[model samples]
Target: MRVVLDAMGGDNAPQVPVRGAVQAAKELGVEVILTGKRELIEDELSKYSYSGNLIKVVDAPESISMDEQPSKALKKKNSSVHVGMSLIKNKEADAFVSAGNTGAVMAISVFSLGRLKGVERPAISTVLPNLKGHTFLLDVGANVDCKPHHLLQFAVMGEAYAKYVLGDENPRIGLLNIGEEETKGNELTKEAYKLLKKASEKGLNFVGNAEGRDIYSGDFDVIVCDGFVGNVALKLSESLAKILAKILKEEIENHFISRLGAITLKPAIKSFKKRIDYAEWGGAPLLGVKAPVIISHGSSNAKAIKNAIKVACQFAESNLNSYIEKNIEKYG
Candidate 1:
């Protein structure tokens, strides 16, 4: 499988992404096409001794900045983000991974790759590591404003993703709301709940409403919400994890005895850190699209990029698009 990487997309840029591509190429045994300035990619590659020539560089002079509007940036034919998406559109690459501007990635993908047969709006599905496994949260920031139908579609697409990625036969899905009762929430949530309930009769594993507090409890495998709420919840959860980690580290270093204890508990702490790191999953998959596209964090590092490629590869191999299309009626 050929996985395309946007070399100049993230904060670390060519170095981290290039290193990741090389590592993925060697370990995952997948061909990686790095899209960026050819000279920079080669320079980075020369710094490390790699096993195979599975990692190739594609020259792309232009790049889309985080602040650039998606529509305006897509006009730049030579932009790295555009070039990378084009690879998927042209069938030259199985999937596209980028840590660049989220808007640019989404805009270019929707324009070039197009949406699935019955998808009204393509949503970004984020995987949150939980005790049971990972919870798939949809509309994580793709569309700020959404209709009830849009949310219902997100639920359907999210369910497909959870089943394929999380390996759940019938993943339990929840609608994010203020209260768990079907009668609670605004008009949108109320309508969405009803739609989901109707859908559950057919095939969807819809479990009533899921409040914000219950998200991290691993109560459900997938949580569906509008972009407005999903984005806020995602950011808050990420921030909370970071703050808690920092507090724990500071407390551990407060005393010499604690420091010694920290050393003894280092392995366990590291494991906990890995579990809470959002980067471990690499990036969020932009579902409901015709092809696989991953939007990585702007601050992603080498390991994150590598994992993002794995995510793309897995999605492509799972034939999720066909699954979503086949089950579109259940969601509609």
Candidate 2:
């Protein structure tokens, strides 16, 4: 499979992304096209030894900064974000991967690749550690404001990802709300609840509302919410993980007995950390787009970038967009 990487997208830029491309080409056995300043890309690439054809570089003179406005950043046609996304639109690449500005990535993807047939808005689906392996959450930061039907669309797309990519034969879908009761939540959830119920008749494994505590409980395979709520939940979960780790470290160092105990439990601690690490999952997929588009964190390292490429390859191989289109038509 051919995957395009935005060489200048992350905080580490060409350095980290270039190293990642080389690793992916060598280890994953996939063709990687790196888009960015050709000179810098080659300079970093030269530091690594790999097969010539497996890794290629495309010159994209401009780059969108992490803080740049999405709409304004798109004007730079030569930017890495635009160039990488264009490669997908042109079918030169099977998927596009970027660690750049999230907004710019979403905007450029929609403008270049367009939406999948019957898709009203594209949602960002993030994979998080859950009790039963992992769960998918949608609209993580794509559309801050959404109507009732939009939530229904998110549920459909989320279900597609769970079934196709995650290999779930029947993924449980839940509306993220304050309570499990059907009567709970605002007008959006109330109305969305009815819509999801109707969709369940069409074969969706629609579960009732999922409360905040249910997120990591693994009771639901996929949770649907507006971008505003999803984003807040995502960030809060991240912060909670970090703070908990920090508190553990401080306590471990506070007493000699605790430090000794930590040493004995080192392996378990390491395993726990790996479960929460974002790099393990690589990145979030922007669902509802014409082709696979994986968006990684701006602070992604080489491992994260390489894994993101793997995810892009998986997405491309899954033919997920086609399934999403069919599901939308089936449930709409």
lDDT per residue for candidate 1 within 123-147, as digits (tens), equals: 9889898886778888889988889
Q: Estimate the TM-score of every prediction.
A: 0.96, 0.98
> Which residue pairs show backbone clashes in model 2?
none
Q: At residue 220, give the lDDT of candidate 1.
A: 89
Best by TM-score: 2
Candidate 2: residue 154 lDDT (0-100):
95
Cα miss at 49, model 2 (Å)? 1.3
Candidate 2 lDDT, 1-332, residue by residue in tens: 99999999989998999998998988899899999999999989888877568998989999789999998997999999888877877888999999989999999999999999999999998999986788899999999999999999999999888888877788999999999899999989999999999999988889899999988998999999999999999999999989998998998899899888887898998998888888998999999999889999999999999999998898899967888898899998
Worst 10 residues of 2 by lDDT: 43-52
lDDT of each: 0.88, 0.91
Lowest summed lDDT across 10 adjacent residues in model 1 is found at: 323-332
